[model samples]
Target: MTTTHDEDAHLASLGYTSDFKRDMSFWGNFSLGFTYLSPVVGVYSLFAFAVATGGPASIWAVVIAALGQLLVALVFGEVVSQYPVSGGIYPWTRRLWGRRWAWMAGWIYMIALLVTIASVSYGAGPFVAMLIGIEPSTAVTVACAVGLIVLVTFLNLGGTNLLAKLAFFGFAAELVGALAVGGWLLLTQRHHGLSAIFDTAGTEGNGSYLPAFLTAALLGVYLYYGFEACGDVAEEVKDPRRQIPRSMRMTIYIGGFASFFITLALLLAVPDFGKVVSGEDADPVTTILQNAFGPVGFRVVLAIVLISFFSCALSLQAAASRLIYSYARDRMMPGWHALSRFSPRRAVPPNALLLAAVVPAVIVLGSIVSENALTKIVSFAALGIYLGFMMVVLAALRARIKGWRPSGPFTLGTWGLPVTLVALTYQVLAAANMSWPRTPDAPWYDNWIVLLSAGIVITIGLVYMLVARPHERHDAPHGDAVASTLDPDSGRATEPARVG
Candidate 1:
């Protein structure tokens, strides 16, 4: 059990054989998390959204969001240690609750990731325009986003090796890029002082600080995710049970801190708060970076930002494809036979990859129809992903309440139940905050967009679950034959424990 092949035996215990080539190193696994949690991409896209909604006072939302997501990530790390499977959330939920719960979780998570790809790419447009010295017109931005989606689709077809390389490159580029540019801004700029972030300038009529804060916190709730990227590709990462849990934690710790720093620095460096909240400079990253770096330095930063955007899409698509492959392999998704087709030689799921590309490409068309497309797309994604997340959290809490104990190497041990309760509470509050309508006089479609869209996604999943009533496999293990265990030394749980 103390060998390199130990992971294979552990995976087989849960009823699957390895189909992926284990080529990702600990760095590669870590890089996957970092790239997926790309700081540059998150702050660049949503910083404006936060400022407009909550002003400088909203800067603290990152810390609050990180604290909550850290709780979520800790639970995820513990689960992943025991159930180190591809399609991380889906399989983990299946092992914790049942096949039905797993199917719905996968459904929600898959759709979230798909919309995330579109949103992140849509966000990338302005940065790319800056690098190439263009105005970042709506058409140019949409085209850029669509083009990158196609590029990542082709790149994914090359297999995991290229993704690993690209992930590492992205990790380096973003870190150096953020620190170099962020560091320069803080050093060269005049003082806005610590009190500036506490200033609620434009939040005059936006209700109490609580509501405005919640809306602004979407930046954090939205930004702090994608750390689970490592677990989704667990089959490909070496020593997954150990490496993945560690990667998940570090992804949140380092990535969260970096994003907060870059955000705070940019906010403090703002020359005119009024221009940022209500004018063309709303996104601020464009103006702030250009102001700090000049046109030449701005392009350099934009280049790094572009690299991050590319890797984020690449990692996101890679994660989504694996989820499809995982579902297909279990005979759950439509056309499972064809989607399950994997080239043992190339170690890739071409059909799943194709589906992943086509869906996002179609989803990105939202950018074409809506003027405020990126915000709506992001809000939609945040809602979907948070719902998907809370399901797993609820499952874990239920299992614990029913007397289930930790069997994972990364168990929270004595603190497990308490942490689970708090985490579930945070997720519920966060999800509600994102779904609430903020506009008082807006059109019906705009006001209820988040709720309507989220409902549609959930309805589709529930209908499928009811119609199919799909089980994990034809000969799914039953009772004692498929029991859970935790080796005192290894702490790996193979199957869901039945509760009386």
Candidate 2:
């Protein structure tokens, strides 16, 4: 029941003012995160790969990843609950650590988000072409992907209200489609029994399944992240300190269930599990859907899938632009003046939105260079996002060790340090698993693309930090000394704590 004035005062105490319309309700925030975490998109994109890599048992990765990410989400809930800032990881890190740490965290995260936007739109291209009855040629796919990016950019430019409405529509459509499709498959098309999920289907290498399972875990890693988008636009949500944390947790709970349900139904519905496991059925999703629903019905399902992709891309763009604007607003990057300009009429950062669209579109064009470019882009995007999450988690741990407690309405209280420690541990292991070079037959660079991409980005950020010193800018408040004094209940300042 925090009022608008209270929200504004909370933001002010954190050294920022309300520049957004604050039209997003708790449901709207949840919808935004749900669409960003787009179970349909993630399941459709990675289903074949996961099955191929780890067989039916790969589904367990979904559960395991959900459990791990829930820990991270709980840690994030405490952080965002206290900070309640628009930039999410960036501001949270700043308040927990220092300006330099926040700068790097934002830098890495912003790049990852841009790459993810490209990856999602690029993924949508095939679906769009399929829905339109066009050949999914490279040229056609690129055109479709770029067109989707442009379409979402315009939608985002329309304002937060439009964004929230489309996100909610997407959430509704995607959820209903998932349920209807999964239920129908379960009732009339299931080819396997309840125990099929436990079968490995001969995917184990040398009698050990751990490697394959870890590779397949990428599906869950990718799906769980979009929940953070709820907090990226924290300033737009009413009573964000309480509502955003709940929205984030709800996003993971609901989105995770939807993902698990769809994946389970798909596994049970496959007409030939051996065909899928042995690579005879390269596209089991299409094979199963076409067999169950026929061409016309499959096309209807494709249309729904296309909507899910569009909404996922839309949410990614929105989150990326907010991070960019947040960086600019704090003068923590070059071109801050131009990127920070907020349109009062639309209550949107038009320039930041444009940057989000343009970078991803350029990345879409990179597909012309190599057929595998999109896959590599996606790999790096996932890695980058996990790394970004780890940075925030690490900062929070450091702050807790230094005696900084979360002073928020939704704090973990005595459990804070334990949750933060576990979340950080999970993130580190997940990230290392993601970056491990598994493809030995492929070129060295191909196998190392994830780490290489991260290294290059980090190197550039480090060079820029040393040269430009954006964190030292004096126009805006830069660190967490002011934040230590914030009263958890009233969002007012008190005597400062002796921690960063």
**Model 1 misses residue 445 by how many Å?**
3.2
lDDT of candidates 1 onward, in order: 0.81, 0.88
Count residue pairs with overlapping backbones in model 1: 0
Residue-level lDDT tens digits of model 1 in 296-320 = 8877777888899999999999999
TM-score of candidate 1 on Cα atoms, chains taken together: 0.92
RMSD of each: 3.9, 3.2
Worst 10-residue stretch by lDDT in candidate 1?
Answer: 474-483
Q: Residue 49 in model 1: shift from native, Å?
A: 2.2
Candidate 2 lDDT, 296-316, residue by residue in tens: 999999999998998899999
Candidate 2's displacement at residue 113, Å, is: 0.5
lDDT, model 1, position 190: 41
Model 1 error, position 303 (Å)? 0.8
Off by over 4 Å in 2: 481-500
